[model samples]
Target: MDGAEREVATLLEQLQGLTSNAEQVEGFRRVQEIVQHRDPSGAERRVLRGALPLLGQIVQLRNAALVTSILQLVAQEASSASSTVTTASAETLDVAAALSAGLYEVCHTVLLLSHSTEKNVVLALQLALGSLHSTFEVALRAETVENGLDTEPRRAWDAATRCLEAAAGIVAIVPEATGSDSNRSAMVWLRAWKFVESGVMLLSTAQDSSVYRDPARSNIQPNTWSLDRLSAGTQAILPKTKLEEFGVMLLKAMCEAVTSKSDNRLPLQRRELSVAVNSLSLLASLRPQHMPNILPKLTALSTVVATPGTEDPVVQKSLTANLVKLLSHPSAQVFADEVTDILIAVGASQRAFSAISKSKEQRRKYTSAPTEASLRRARIGKRTATQSITERVENANAHAKRRRVNLSESSATPIPAEKHWQLKKVRSECVILGSGETQDSKHRAKNNQHWCQFLMK
Candidate 1:
């Protein structure tokens, strides 16, 4: 081996000895120095790339200090790469690809721990997930421009999808295991919502197909990639097949989770429902090739909710609301409006059926301001003097205050005025009787009461 290659190998070995946080930070400090060198060798570049997965190992052990170090390194490297105005080179491309791959591995490993019962472990995993998601995204954009249709970018996306799957699993399992009423369950469900939201956001990139297309054929031969295999290789049949499969599986699972009841419990929480619907809406917006089949599956689930004796009124109402949202969706226009009747049959209120129409009308009226006073009349009733919203709020507050005063008065103790007066009069008579000196004193006291004495005379 060459002297430079030997030196690079030795440096990497020293990096492995970085057992302490201080040592790791110092090691990365030197690595950064090497990166900033005017002409870094391929071996040095490899060392930098190799260090990324090592950080993943530290993260696996759930070491807070090491994890922080790794995150800072990622941020530093990413910021430096993005902010630089230099021309791209083959070595730079390699570093970017390696960084992307390592970050993906880290995210995938962390996500596998998402279902942990330990709060700390779960929290760390979530942090790792967020870091990996953002880091991988930036790397993908940078690398895709340099190395068009590269497998590394596709692999990065797959890692993100896998992370989402792990997150969703955590969401489903925690509530089921903990009886849905525990504090832990609530927190885990919250994490689950975050994961779902992230997953949807990640999937949103598909809206721009040019940015997220399958890898093109390489000179190596008839080249293609699968979800399981994102790199350019001699492939027999299809590309992105597995990715499509994963998307389908994810959508189906989410739909079922949102709609199906858990024995006696309600279907997923309301938040989960909203997140799931949002994810599905995004997926639908992407106009996936398999959406026709997916839409039918979604509609079938809603149909069962419409049938009698499946869920209680509250569950039915929630499911119906989601279904209505789906039907009124801009993406779902291709699907028939049959869901309205299904909703009504399932005991959806009349308001629920007319909700979409009303919303459309409201939007239309807002867009086109009416000049005619008659057209501007209130739909619900006659306008009451056209008060400003602020004025209305003030009036409402005053009314509420009056109601509060009335309520306080109604709950207050009686004043007992009559009893008080009678008590005072009795006390005065008692005092008169107690103070009397004798019959002569009594006659003098009676003479002092002039009106009564005159009447007696």
Candidate 2:
């Protein structure tokens, strides 16, 4: 074997060692640095692919450090290939094809580990989320750029598409992984949302006609294309429908989290609401046909707006403004009638608020019980804090009597104090008659003596 081949072999050994035993972490880091910066020769790249099989085996060990190293290796490979593909088109680097071979299992393993009850596994998966997104971004970039180039990189595009589909499939398994842990489900869903968001943002930038690049580097110049222009220009390669699908997936995941809450209100935080609203707004702008489908969720956000717990009024107003802005657009004029109803239902304007309040008054008659129940619970809670002194004393006495009765119920007989006292009186009378006793004793001493002990019963 050549020197490059020997290096690849040694790196693969390190990766294997790292997986079997975590002590080899430094070895894995060396491999990462070589792939990322040293720019390994083609012979070494081919040999590095050999580690793909070992990824599945090591993931079973569920060691965060080792698993992360394995994923980092894959990420570095994809990053290296990405740099090459954009710069040196003359020499094709099919990293996607090589990585896609093992991408599905890696993603699946991470998905499983993400929901682990163990803190270490969950944290490791969180750390790995960035690597997963990087991998997906490369696939998306390849797919988007396939049409822009004169000769289509069909293999890379196909591999990239498969990876994306696999990622989507992994999202479907998130619920199963979380089981009954709502917090875990929310976390998994957030990660999935972010993954989908990266794709959607890329697609959006590509689709925008207004985007322009510094034209110093064209196809001949290759990788010199400015990021903004390259991203925008790549828009021509991806279908609008495919992009919308990703956006919809993100929205679906977010909606799942919101709906999973006991009260079914959108999260009150600015960041969470902003993301949901902005995403919906972008989707509406891109796919007007889906406006009808998106309106219900937008309107249903009223509960979030009306929620008393949130301190910020601007959050609600901001959501309202976005909806109004979208509906009022000239292109959206066709949706005017539907828009009017949704606006009124969401109480976005004075007329809308009036209509809603009137209808709410009518509905309040039937729905009064829920409000009443809440008020009743609140009253019961307060009564404990402000109980009257008489009531408190009565309760204390009742409790003491109940405790005494319970103690008596457990015994075979009650104390015979009354009978013993009567016998004591008779004995004292006999003693008084038989012997002249002092008529005077300390009144306190007489009173302190137990009449029952004097009876000698």
Candidate 3:
């Protein structure tokens, strides 16, 4: 086993040392064969651990195959952090360390350009970023690390911020990459924002209740991303520079979503935009300077969706009330005078102003009472084919499951066995003559249909 490790390491070095582009490509393929064909105990992890660094080697070569191999490896191997080398172990930083500027530049270039766009590349990039964010999320939330460093701003944290940048930068380019999946782009935005969101939540203890919150969020599970819920450190300071970069990227993403109206106008995509508005509002409250950058986009949010109300959050809070909750959040002090006129321009109702004075409970009072969140996701009057199939399967399983005796509907006492039918049955010699019932039957118990069975005759 030691010999095999040496052999793999030796092969990797030789692969990197090769100057000829053609031979290096061949050598790269050979390395994959050696690791995987040899049937190592953890072939995927080994291949990934060995291949991730290979990305830098091929960056100058411009070989999509090599880049794709590493990405596909990361996509497949990094999904389960428990088994992969990227897990939150002592060597956890290894994976983050390998996310070189070369890798980011390559991914960013491929993701941003339509002609260069590849689905495999996109999928792999999404998986890689999401996995890294989730992985470091634990360390950031830890009370203290093994290295005695602060929760964030360390090597691991620095790499995590890189992941946020990479993800958000891809989000900014999603509109231009005409062939890329809009859904995937939205997901990347969500992942990037969530990483930032957790960081802020951990640092901001005083403002938890003060922020404009979605009531539906109260019912959902908190985004811990860890098995044993590690809360954030209130005193942990976030890097102001990187935090501002996230706000900037979020604004870019929101702009792209609007510009690509044909692709992003659906309820789901619009819902994502609404969440971004709320998130920007949250960031602005913490840092007032973000308000100026975020306000125009919030006004552009005149196109809010109707569903997802009272779900994770009411989109822009107005989407929760279908245009009623677009109040002037305190973050909008810069444009306080224009908010009402803007809301009016966007077709917001009289309730938009009236609801401002309402209390938190009262703010949501005007929420569409009919649009209840079913199955914890608020969707109404809309069902895709997949959702229809899912609902059917769920309903079938629900019907097959046994009901509690206490909760089951009581039997109707046989509906009193209609007296007219009973009298007619008696005339036809088919009256029941059970011991508890009337024994005034016209026929013996054996002859009565009430006591009959499918006898063999």
Candidate 4:
């Protein structure tokens, strides 16, 4: 037999053995050697290229640990200098393709496992989904930037689109399992939604940057392309229509899970529901202009939050934050009364105040205190002692007012600008009202004064 034929035979035998024995580490090592061997024209190299399909099959087995290892190797190779060579390029592309296929398989497997009676498998699937989402993102981004294209690389974008499509499908699969039986799956879906949200945000950010808008910029950063170009390529795969469908489905599933009163699913459902609410909140915040599209989804979620006897502290907090932000949307006033009622019912106002107060304290503690010696050093000029006193008093009053405002929610009490200078002087010496009340309060007070003086001077 020819050398190439012999090498192919040997590699195939190793793959079969590895799979039969489930020797994941050994199998991965063998794949690595095949891809990395220096001999360009050698039989082993040719055989290795042919073995891509087999590697894909192994990933399809739903072994997340193995999939993770393979993905890491692929990412590492893709990032290396060797990946740019002509011969190495084909191998890199093949590896990327294989990994993408395997990722889809893994996602599918997770969907199936989500239905398992075993808790471990469900939890494992949730964790696996998270890892797979991140890996897919890295691979997708790498492929796009691999070679500077005037437009996004269609192949890479298509692959990413498929991955997200698969994820959406997985989320849809467990709609009926909404109560406890599917709580874990719901959490996985929530995370997957975040992955999609971030991807869109990145795309949007890229579109807004000069790199995408001006072709005259000689060195266009990789992945920077006109939104028009992106929209065209992504139209079929992640069109607005598809996004709306997915968004609606996600909202429905989360609401069902969260509102489920079944004893078995209550805890898990509540946890997943909290995550879903947070994810929705983030999406709303990042894409406020898309409120018309998002409002209905929020409405559905709000219904669950508003349900009597379902006032979970965590969920309430999440819902309140989302609603407060939603108030900024033009259509928010339509639901303002209901949203406000829920916020108050859940004590979100008090919670928000407490959070603000704590944040002020934290800011105060971490900031450096202005020493009297530093103040004295600043009085180098023939400025009158009264002038210094006036400045110090202004700094102290300003600092005190800020501490009060930050600690209190009332927006009506605006401290005079001159008072800030007085507050600054006393900020280092005496504790401002509400200052040093808590660790967070002290830090916050100190930070406020530090920034105020820094800016004023």
Who wins the lDDT comparison? 1
- Model 2: lDDT equals 0.48
State the displacement of the C-alpha of residue 65, model 4, in Å, after optimal TM-score superposition. 5.3
Range of the 10 consecutive residues with the lowest summed lDDT in candidate 3:
219-228
lDDT of 4 by residue, 69-111 (tens): 5555544443342233234343444444444444444334434
List, residue by residue over 1-457, the lDDT tens digit for candidate 3.
4454557667767866767767766776766676555636452244445544545444434455555665554444444432343344434433433333224444444444444324544554654455554444534433244553342224444554455555555545432223354424555556545544444433222232233343223432222331224333332424444444554555555445433244235424544556655665554443334456655655545433322331223454543342233343443444644666655654554655664544224233212223345533545356688989999999887766644342344332232346545545644764446667644443464455542222111
**Sort by lDDT, top down from the best:** 1, 2, 4, 3
Worst 10 residues of 4 by lDDT: 208-217
The model with the greatest TM-score is 3
Clashing pairs in 2: none
Model 4's TM-score against the true structure: 0.49
Candidate 3 segments whose C-alpha is farther than 4 A from its true place: 9-30, 33-52, 79-116, 141-143, 147-156, 166-174, 177-206, 210-293, 300-323, 328-337, 357-457
Question: For every model shown, what is its TM-score relative to the native structure?
Answer: 0.51, 0.49, 0.51, 0.49
For residues 1-457, write the lDDT of model 1, one tens digit per residue: 4443345446556766657766766765565555445224543355455455556655554344445555555545544543331354544544554554565566556556533334543453465455544444344344435434456545555555666687667655535444433324656656655665444334322422212211111111110111322235532222345545555565556555655553344455545554555455444534344345445645555555445654445544654665565554444545635666666666765745565564344221111223456445653255455556656889999999998897687557453676556545544443253553787757655654543323222
Summarize candidate 2's per-residue lDDT along 66-138 as a digit string, tens digits.
6666665665565555454444332343454355335444545565554333433333344344444344344
RMSD for each model, in Å, please?
Answer: 17.0, 19.8, 11.0, 18.5
